[model samples]
Target: MTEFPEGIESGFAAARQIADAVLLEGYVLYPYRASAAKNRLRWQFGVLVPPEYTAQGGEHSHQRTECVMEARQDDRLAVELRFLRVQRRTVERATATGGFEPVERLELADRVLVEWDEAVEERIEILVPVEELMGEGVQQGFRLPGVGETELLREDGTAVGRLVRRREQVDGVVRLKAEELPGPYRAQRLTAVVENASTWIPRRRTPREEALPRALVSAHLLLGLEHGRFLSVTDPPEWARPAVERCRNEQTWPVLAGPDDGCKVILSSPIILEDHPKVAPESLGTLYDATEIDEILALRTAALTDEEKREARGTDARAGAVIDLAESMPPEVLERLHGAIRGLREISAGTPDGEQPWWDPGNDPAVDPERDEVLVDGHAVAAGSRVLLRPGRRRTDAQDLFLAGRTGVVEAVLHDVDGSVHLAVTVEDDPGADLWRAQGRFRYFQPDEVTPLEES
Candidate 1:
C-alpha cells in the first residue's frame, strides 16, 4: 500500500472510530469555557448495546474503543487540555480555593448525568447517553442488553440512576440533581482567561529626589526689606533680609514679593511669569514699588535664562503704556479716566488712550456762541439775547472766577420788556483767586472796557 500522509491517516482512523462508537453507543461532546482562561470539556451521552453483543466477552474491548474515539475527536483538544492544565495549576497555587471531592450520577430516559463537587469550590457535570456506557461495558463482557433507568440511593438522601435505549421520543434531555454543592464551577473558573488578558497595565512612577533645605534657608536669609515688603512676607521686618537670601541661594523658590506693602507677590516660573503681579494695595504707585522688588528677584533667578528675562521685559513694556497715560492727563481727568480705562483694559490689552483719541464736548463749536448773541447749533444767531460765550484769553480766568466766585463787572447791560436787566460782565484776574488761573471768552472782564462783538 502507498504510504499515507501521517495527519490524514490519523484523521481518517479517528473519524472511523468515532462513527463506530456512535453507531453502537451515542455520545455528545459539549464545550465549556473554550474562550475562558481555563478551557474545559464535557461529554453528554446516550448509548445502546445489542443483546447479542452483551452476551459476548467484549466489554473491555469496547471501553478501549470509546476512549480512543474521544481522544481523536477534535484538533483543538490538545490546546484545550493544555489550557485546563494551566488553569488547574493556577488554582492549586492560588491563595484561594484548592481541593477535590466525590462524583455523583443521575439517569433519565436515554441519558445519564455524572457530576462531581470539588473542594476547590468547583462542580463538574457530564451528560452521556445510557446506551454508550452499557454498550462499552457489554462489548468488554459484562452481560446486560444495555443500562436502563435504575435508582441507586447514596448514603445521604441524594439519588443516582442509569438508563439506555436504542431510540426513544426523549432523545436529547438529561436532568441532574445534587444538594449543597460547593461552587465556582468549571464553567465559572474558566472565565478568567479573557478577563486577565484584557486587564490594563499600570503606569510606573518616577522616583523623587530630596530637596536641599540648607540652600533654601540660605536664599530665604538673603531676602531684603524691599523684596519682603512687596511679596507681603512681613516677617518681623528682621526676617525680610534672610528670606530674600534664602530665595537667591536655593534658586528653586518660584515667587517673590511685589512693590506694595509686601502683600503682593510675583511668580518666577515661566508659565505664569509674564502675567501681572497680585498686590493688595492696587495702584500705579503701590504696584511700582512691588514690581521693582519682583524684578530684582527675577533678575537673580533668570540670570542664566535669557527667555525668562525676555518675558519679564515684555510685561514691563505693556505696563509702561498705562503709566504714560497717567502722567499725561490732569489729576482729576486721570482719576476718572483711570477708572474707565481700568475696566476697558481688563477686556482688551492696549491702554484706552491708544484705542481712541480724547474729544471734549466743551470744545465743540455748536454749543458755544459769540458775545452779544445766542447761537443755536452754530447755524443761527439771535442778537440782544442774554447768551453765554467762551471768552478770549485775556479775560478768560476773571470770567471763570466771576461765574464761579459769583462776583464780577456788568460789562454790558440789556433792559428787557419785563424790566429785568441782564448784565454782560468781564472780570480781571485777581491775585487772591488761584482758582481763576485759566482764561476763557464767556468769563467776566472789566465793565468799563466792555466791547460787544456783533452776531454773525
Candidate 2:
C-alpha cells in the first residue's frame, strides 16, 4: 500500500476539523467530486434533513451529519460529504443489498425522499484538489452554472436561433423581434427583457406626436379667458412658476424655433372667438390663420407684456384669499342656515289644521295699537296661534330684526299674553352673547299694513 505524505495528512486533518464544526450543528454531508488527473482531487459538499427536524412533536425527531478532509501537503487535495434524508423504501434498498458494495456505489438516490412520521439525518464528505490544498490551505470554491442560447420567433412569424442577439429594423426604428413563448410566460419574459434593455433601447413617441394638436387647442381655450389675457408668456405669474419650470426642463414646446415660437404662443395672444357677440377691428384681434406664421408671431408680441404679468399675479393672490375665507367658515353655521331655509318653506305651505294667527284671516295681529286684532292670510300663519319670523328682505320686521341682514328663515314664533311676539330666526353669524344683542326685538305689523318684500 502507498503511504500518504505528511503534508497530505495535515491537509486532510484541517478538512476534518471544518467538517466536525459544521456536523456538530446537525448538518449532513454528500459525496465529494472526484479528481480528473491522477495527482489531483476535487471536492463537493451537500446536506439534507427530513421535515420532522423542524416539526413540533418530539415523536418526529431526525438526524443529520457531514465530514470534509484535505491532503496534508496540498491544500487543494480536499474532500467534502453530505448526507440526505430518505424514505423507508429508499433505505430498505441499501439494507437489502447486504452492505457488500462500496459506500459510494450504495443504492441511495441523489434526491431526498422524506417520510412524514419522523425526521432523518444524513452525513457527507468532500474531497479537494491536492495541488490547491498544498498551496492555499483551502480548496473547492463555489461557481454558478452558465445559461445556454435560446431559439425565438419574430413578429412576422420567422423563426431564428440566438434570439437575444437578434434585432429588427422597421421604418428607421430598431426593435427586438417577438419570440415564440407561452402567453403568460412570454409576458413576464418580455417585461424582464424590456427592463434590462431599456438603457440601450430607443422608445417610439407616435402617440405623443398625435396628441400635440389637442394640447395646443386646450392652451388656446385658456388664452380666451380674461385671467389668461392678463398673463405674459415671457414672464408668467408666480403661481404658474412650477409649470413654467417643468416646460423649460422638459423642452416640450409646440414649435421649437424662434424666440416667439413654442409653448410661449399660448400666453402671447388672445384666442379669436368666432362665436362671440362682440366684434373688433381687423387689426385688433389675432385670427386662427394657420397659413400665416408671421401673423401669429406679431399677435403674440402685441399681447404679452410685463404689466400684464403683474396683473395676473395680483388676480391669482385675490382668488387665493377668497378661497381661504370660504374654507375657514364654521360648519355649524352652514348647517343652521340650511335648516332655517327649509323651515321657512314648510311654514309658508301652512299646517294641515290651518294658518297661524299672524297669517290667519281673522283676529290678525297688528303693530298698530288701534287695531287690537286684524285678519291675515290664513295659510301664512301656523295654527292661527303663533307666527314665524325669518331674516332676508322677504321676512317681516319680527324676523328681520332678530336676524339682521344675515339671510335665513324663521323657524317658530311665540306670543305672550301681553301681546308681544317672540321670533326664532336662524342666521350665519357666530353664536355668542353678542349675537343676541345684535338681534333686535320683533315688532308686530297690521294685516293690511303688511307688505311682502321681494327676494334678494
Candidate 3:
C-alpha cells in the first residue's frame, strides 16, 4: 500500500482510482509526442470528439459520457469531475509538392512550407461551350452514363451542365468534444458531437500547434459519501498528497497553457467512501493485478526514471513488489517469460473457458504437446525420429498389413501443399513391406499415433 495509504474500500472509491489509472495509461507516447501516431492508439479510454467535428470553425459541443453512481445509505454522494481539454490553436501547414498539382512524390522537397490555409476551396469550376458534357470522341452510337449535379440553370433557364464536386484535404481538423453531464453522479450523463476520431489520427500539425484538445480523454472524477465526516471528493487527507504527486510527476502531461497553468493534470481516482470508522486516506492502497503489471512492464512505458520509480515505489507497495520482481529477473529469463506469456495470451484471446486453446497442437487434449520448442530427455525428437507404435486397434482387413507395438524409423515428415503435417514412418519389421511401394514403404500418422522410442 505504497501510494494511497487510505482505507478507500468502497466501490465508488475503487472505480475512481481505476479511472485515473486508465487515463494516464497510454495518454501520451514514449518520448512524449506533441503529435502522436495512429498505430499507437493513445488516449484509448473515455474518448470524446476528434478534430473533424470542429471543421465548420466555430465553438461546438459534441459527445456525451454518463457515469452512474449508486446512492449511499444516506442516498447521496459527492463526486468531483476532472479532466483535461487539449487546446488546439489553429495554424497552417504546407506540402512539399509546392502546389496541389500532381507531382512525382520524389520531386517534393522538405524545405517547402505553407501556412495553415483555412477556407481552401475544395472544388474547381470551368465553363464549357456545350449545353451538356461532350468530348471530341465518337458520338452517334456511343452510350454515355450521365453525371453531375442537376445542371444549374441561368436566369434565362439555359442549363450549364458543368460539374460541381468537392475534394478532400490531405490533412485537416474535425470536430471532437467530450463534456460531463450536468446531472448528479447517481445519474450523470453528457452530450455532444465528435465523440472520437473517425479516422486514426496522425501528427497533423507542428509540435507547437499540436493540442491535447478540450475533451474527456483525460477526465478524472471522485465520487464518495458526504455524510459522517466524509471529505470532499476534491480533497483528500494530507497523507495522500505524496501518492498523487508521484502519479502526476511520472505521467507528466505538463500544462503547456491553461488557467491553473501547471504541467500535471490533477484529479483523484474515482472511489466510493463510506461511514465506516476504519476508512481513511492514510490507510488506502490500490488493488493489484499481476496481468496488468506484466503488460505495463512489457510496454516499458512512462515512469521509468529512477526518481519516478522511487516515488512510485514509495506510494505503491504492490507496484514496488512487481517492479522489484521484474527488475531482479535475469534479462534472458525475463525476455523468454515475457515472450512466451505474450504468445500464450495471444493464443487464448477470445477463447471461452474450458476449451482447448488455439495454441494446443493437434487440436486434441489427449496429446498435450508444446511444439514451439520441445525438450525430450535432453535431446529433441523431430525429423528422422525412431518411434514405437502404441498397441492400438487395427481393422480386420488392415490387421496383417500393420502391427501394433512395432518399432519404426521416421522417414520424411511430409507436409501437404496446404500445410498439414504428417509423420512419415517406415515399419522396418513389416512382413508385407515388399508389397508396398519402394523407399522402405512409409506410413503417415498423426503426431499422437507414434511415441518416440528414444531421442534420435
lDDT of 3 by residue, 160-196 (tens): 1221322121221221121222333322111111222
TM-score of each: 0.13, 0.13, 0.26
Q: Give the alpha-carbon lDDT of every model.
A: 0.24, 0.24, 0.34
Question: Could you give the candidate ranking by lDDT, starting with the highest?
Answer: 3, 2, 1
Residue 150, model 3: Cα distance from true site in angstroms: 56
Q: Please report the candidate that would top TM-score against the real structure.
A: 3
Clashes of each: 66, 60, 53
**Runs of candidate 2 exceeding 4 Å displacement:** 1-4, 14-18, 27-76, 85-456
Residue 36 of model 3 has an lDDT of 22
Candidate 1: list runs displaced more than 4 Å. Answer: 1-281, 284-340, 343-367, 372-456
Error (Å) of candidate 2 at residue 382 is 68
Per-candidate Cα RMSD to the true structure, in Å, reads: 43.1, 38.8, 24.7
